[model samples]
Target chain A: MEIISFMIAPLAATLILGGILVYFGIHVIKREIVFIDIALAQIAALGGTLAIVLWPETINGGGHEEGHHLIEYLFSLLFTTLAAGLFSLLKSKKIRIPLEALIGISYAVATTAMVIILDKGAGSDVHIHDMLTGAILWVGWDKVLRLAGMVLIVALFHWVFRKNMMNLTDNYDNSSYKSKRKNWWDFLFYFTFGLVIVEAVQVGGILTVFAFLIIPASTTLLFFSTWRARILAGLLLTVILTIPALWVSWTWDLPASPVLILFLGIILIISGLVYQIKKKVT
Target chain B: MNTLLFLGPPIVISVLLSIILGYFGNHILSRGIIFIDIAVAQVAALGTMIGLLVGFGEESLGLEMTSYFFTIVVIGIFALTKFADQKVPQEAYIGIIYCLGLGLALLLAERISGGSNFISKTITGNILWTTWKDVWISLLLFSLIGAIHVFFQKRFQSISLNKSENSSINRTRLYDMLFYMTFGIVIVKAVPIGGIFLIFILLIAPAVSVTLFTNNWRKRLIGSWIIGSTGSVTGILLSYSLNISNGPAIVCLLGSLAVILTLWVILRKRTVSV
Candidate 1:
C-alpha cells in the first residue's frame, strides 16, 4: 500500500503527459515530422542552459528558488516560441530543402550550443547530467498538479481548435486547402507542441517523452485507422505500459523513466511483430 | 605559438572530418535519410556502453570491435526494413531506433558509477585533447574510405540519387548495406572524437549548404569539401579565440552558415519574384 501510494503521483504524471503526447504524436506521424519533438526539446534545453549561464545564481546554489525557476521557464518558452515561428515560416512552398534536414540541423545546433554554453557556465556538470536523465521516480504531487493544470489548458486549446487543426494536418498535401490562415494554425500547433515538450522534458527527460510521443502512437497506428480509435488506444496502451513499468522500477530500485521507455519499446516491438505476422497471413 | 601547438591536432582532425564527412553528407542528404547518422551514432554509443558494462577498458580494441558489431547489426536491420509497403514511414523507424538506443544507454549508464560523464562525453567529445596519433589514424582511415568511394562512385551515386530502379532488389539491398556499413564505420570513428552532435552537423550542414548552389555531382562534392573545410577551419579559430569547446564551436559555425545560406536563397527567390 505504501509503495502504491508512492507510485500514484508518477502514474498520474505519465497518464496526463502521455495522453497529450500521443495526440501530438498522431499529428507528428501524419505530418512526417517525427523528429521535431527532439529538436524542439533541445532548443528548450538550450534556453534553460542560457538562463543558467546569464544568471549563475539561478541554478548555481542548488536550492530551489521560485524566481529562478520562472526565469528558466520563460527563457525556454521564448526560445520554443521562436522555434515554432521559424518552423512555420520555413514550411512555405518556395523553400526547396526537406523539412527533416532543417529539423536535424536545428537539433544538432541547439544541442551543441547548449554544450558550449554549459562549458563556460558554473555547475555545468550537474546540469548536463540532469538534463539527460529525468527524475520521474522522485516527482511529487505538487509538480504533478502543476503539469496537470498546464496539460488541461493545452487540451482545451486543442479542443477549441480541433477542426481547423485536424483539417490542416489531414489536408496538408492539398494545395487548395493550404492558405495563409493555415500558416497561423500551423504556428499554433507547433507553439502548443513546444509548450507541452518543455514541460514534459523537464519531468520525463527527452527519451521517455519521445517514447511516450512516438511509440504508443506508432503502435496504435498499426492497428487502427481512425483518429478516435488511435488516440483512445494509444492512451490505453500508455496506461497499460506505465503501471507495470513503474511497479518493476520500484521493485528493482531502477530508474523509472528509462524503465518506462524500455517497456514502451518492448511493447512497440511486440506489436510490430504481430503487425508483420498479421500482414503476412492476410 | 603555444596555442598553435595545443590546437593543431584538433584542427587537423576537423579538416580530416570535413574532407570525409562532407562527402558522406552529400550522400546522406541526397538519400533523404538525414537523421540516420545520429541514430547510428547513438546505437554505436550503446555498444560502447555495453562494452563498459562488460569490463572493457575505455580505448580497448575490444570496445572498438563491439561498437562495430552493434553498428553492423543495426545497418542490416535498416537495410532489411526498407520495405515499400509498410504503413509506417522509414523516418518513424529511425526516430524509434534513436530513442531506444538512447533509453537503453541511459538504463545501463545508471548501473555504472561515473556513467553520466561517459554519456556527456559521447554527446560532446573531448576534441581539444586529441593527439597527433589520433589525427594520423583518422587520416589513414578516411583516405581508404575516400578511395573506395572514388572507385565505385557511379554505383553509389546511382543508389543515392534513386536512379537504380532497374536493379534487382537483392542487388540494391546489397548496395544499401554497403552504403550504411561504410557510413556506420565513419560514424563510429567520429563519434568518440567529435561526438554525435558534431558528426551530425558535419554530415548534414555542408551538404545542405553546397546543394543550395549546384546540382552537378563533381561540383557539389567539391563545393561541399571547400565549404566544410573552411567552416571547420574558421570554427576552430573561433573556438581558440573565444575560449569555448571545439566541437560545439565548429557545429555552431557550420550550422549558422547553413541557416544563413538558406535565408539568402529564400530572399533571392523573393527578389526575383518581385
Candidate 2:
C-alpha cells in the first residue's frame, strides 16, 4: 500500500505519456524512422549536459532542481529543434545521403559530444547513465504536472493540424520532394515531436521514452491492420503492461524505468510471435 | 620539440589506421551498414563489461576472450541474418542490434565500479595515454585485415558493392565471412584505443566525404586517406597545443571536414544542374 501510493505519481505520468505516445507511435511506425526518438532523446540529453556544464548548480542524479529546470529545458528544446531543422533540410532531393544515415550519424555525434562535454566539466558517467535511464521513482507532483501540460500542448497542436499530421509519415519518397509546404509540415512535426521528447526523456528517461514511442505502436501494428485500430491497441497494451511493470518494480524494489522497458520488450516480442503464429494459421 | 617527439608516433599510427579504416569505411558505406562499426564496438564493450563483472581486469586474457566472443556473435548475426521480405530496410535491424547492445551495456554498467567512467572512456577513448604496444598491435591487426582485403579485393567488392554480380554462391559466402571477420578485428582493436567516436569518425567520415566527389574506389580510397590523415595530424597538434583530449579533438576535426565536404558536394551538384 505504501509502495502503491509512492508510485502513484510516476504511474499517472506514465499513463498520460503512454496515451500521448500512441499518437506519436503512429507517425513513427509509418515513417519507419524507429530510432528518431532515440536520436532526439540523445540530442535533448546533450542539451541537458551542456546546461550542466555551463551552470554547475543545476546538477543532480535523481532529478534536477526545480528553479533551474527551465535552463535545462530551454537548452534541450533548442538542441532538438535545431537537429530537427537540420534533418528536415537534409530532405532536399539533391542530397543523396539517406535520412537514416544522417540520423545514425546525428545520434553518434550527439552522444559522443555529450560524453566529451561531461568529461571536461568534471561530470561523472553516472550522470550520463541517469540521463539515459532516469530516476522515475523520485518524480514529484510538480514534475508530473509540468509533463502533463507539455503533453496537452502537443496533443492540442496535433489535433489542430490533423490533416498535416496524417500525411506526415506517408511514403516519403513520393511526397518528400513535392512541395515546400510539405517540407514545412515535416519540420513542424519534428519540432513539436522534439518538444515532447525533451519532456518525456526528463520524466521517464531515454529507454522509456523510446519504448513508449516504438513498442506500443510496433506491437499494435503486428495485430491491427489500420492506424486507428493500431492506436487503440497500443493504448490498451500500455495500460495493461505498465501496471504490471510498475508492480514488478515495486515488488522487487528494482528501478522502475528499466523494468518498464523490459516489460515493453517482452510484450513486443510476445505480440510479434503471436502475430506470426496467427499469420501461419491463416 | 618534446611535444613533437611525444605526439609524432601516435599521430603517425592514427594516420596509418585512418588510411586502412578509410578503405573499410568506403566498403561499409557501399554495404549500407554505416553503424556496424559502432554496433560491433558496443558489443565488444559489453563483453569487456561482463569481463570486469566477473573479476577480469581490462588487460586480462579473460577479458580479451570475452570481448572477442561478443564481437564474433554480433558479426555472425549481422552476416547471416538475411530477411526474405525486402520491405524492411537493413538499417532497422542494425539499429535494433545497436540499441540492444547499448541498453544491455548501460544496465551492466550500473553494477560495475566506476562503470560510467569506464563506459565513457570506451566511447571517447583516451588516445594520448596509448603505449607503443597499442600502436604495434593495431598495425599488425589492421595489416592482417588489409591483406585479406587486398588479396580478395575484387571478390569482396563484388559481393558487397555489386550485389548482382555475386552469383557464384560458394565464393560469395566465403568472402562474406572474410569481410565480417576482418571488420570485427578492426573494430575490436580500434574501439579500445581510438575510442568508439574517433574510430567511427575515421571509418565513415572520410569514406562518406569522398562519395560526394567520386564513386571510383581507388580515387575514393586515396582521397579519404588524405583527408583522414591530414585531419588527424592537425587534430593531434591542436590537442597538444590546447591541452585537450586527443580523441574528441580529432573527432571534431574529422566531423567538421565531413560536413564541409558534404556541403561542397551538394553545392557543386546544384551549380551543375543550374
Report every candidate's CA lDDT. Answer: 0.85, 0.76
lDDT of 1 by residue, A1-282 (tens): 899888888899889988999999999888778889989999988997688679987577778698788888899999999999888876656655677888888888898787777676566666666766688888888888878888889899999989988889888656677556887899999999998888887788777888888888889999998889999999899888899999999999888887888998899889988988998999
Candidate 2 RMSD computed on C-alpha atoms after optimal superposition onto the true structure: 3.5
Each prediction's DockQ against the real complex: 0.68, 0.33
| Clash count list over all predictions | 0, 0
Question: Tens digit of lDDT per residue, candidate 2, span B150-174?
Answer: 8988888876676477256555666
As for candidate 2, its clashing pairs are none
Candidate 2 lDDT by residue in tens digits, A145-235: 9899988998899889887778656657664335448868889889989988887877888777776876677667666767679778888
Candidate closest to the true structure, highest TM-score: 1
TM-score of each: 0.95, 0.88
* TM (B chain), model 2: 0.93
Best by lDDT: 1
Native-referenced Cα lDDT, model 1: 0.85
Q: How well is candidate 1 docked (DockQ)?
A: 0.68
Error of model 1, residue B41, in angstroms: 1.3
Interface RMSD of each: 1.5, 2.8
